[model samples]
Target: MPKDTILVVDDSPTEQRLVAAALSLQGYRVITAADGEEAIEKAAKELPRLIVLDVVMPKKNGFQVCRQLKTTAATQNIKVLLLTSKSQDSDKFWGMKQGADAYMTKPFTDGDLVANITKLI
Candidate 1:
């Protein structure tokens, strides 16, 4: 059984809960952050195996946070999976540039989300 922890970061409470619950059902320990700053703080403290991040958010946005986490040695190894409604090609490009291990657009199914998480974690 995989016991790795995952951090879900999103501004929408509804989205956050959906992601959290799905991962929890898969037996991965789940934690959540409502925005970028909190996400960064929790990622540092928890050292989770993966981080499910949202692009549009207050405080710091997912790309910025991903860059910060990737550049820092302590958190660089933590896999970052960018999940967002921003489906532009440029958005995907920039997400990869910022060190996102994977990018999945919003309106994703629970199975797809779990598949991505499993791949990353």
Candidate 2:
């Protein structure tokens, strides 16, 4: 069977690498985008099983990307996991409203990240 592909989007290189490494360690095929525009393009083209998106980014934010993805026919079905430092309840609410399958904050454990992705895919 093919390994599940996950797109990890974050503006910070360290954060992106860390997330990618964790997912890769768990046998996932990981791709990455440094900002939201690239993320949108990759999502439409790659159709990854899930997107790990960061809320604050140049070109666009996670909410904007998520909203666009959810509304666009080609990418609408792709699951999105908002992985951001935004921990406010309102931020979580907005993420869900934008059609995220799950919202996870930064400074998270690899175990929690894997568990969330497991539940989603």
Candidate 3:
């Protein structure tokens, strides 16, 4: 199978590296962004198959980015997975409402992460 690229958006360097490494180990081409604005720019330019987004970010938030990406025709088809520390039911609801294809919490196992990525991309 052809390798797929995944964009991981997070303000925390540790989280960013952790996710990137996990995805890379699974043979994915991992790209990263430190903020939501950068995420949007990279998403539009790189056109990755999937984006792992964080809810709280600078410049823009994951929900905002997800909404814009989903509403914009050019980038709407890219699958968005909200991987965040927010575990509230309301947050998950809001994320899904904002067009996130999947909502996952932080402290996630590599197994679950890969499973979600496999299902999405």
Clashing pairs in 3: none
What candidate 1 gets wrong by more than 4 Å, as runs, is: none
lDDT of each: 0.96, 0.96, 0.96
What's the residue-level lDDT of 50 in candidate 3? 97
Residue 43 of candidate 3: its Cα lDDT? 96
lDDT (tens digit, per residue) of candidate 3 on 1-33: 538999999999999999999999999999999
TM-score of 3: 0.97
Query: Of models 1 and 2, which has the larger lDDT?
Result: 2
Clashes of each: 0, 0, 0
Across 1-121, the per-residue lDDT of candidate 2 in tens digits comes to: 4489999999999999999999999999999999999999999999999999999999999999999999999999999999999999999999999999999998899999999999999
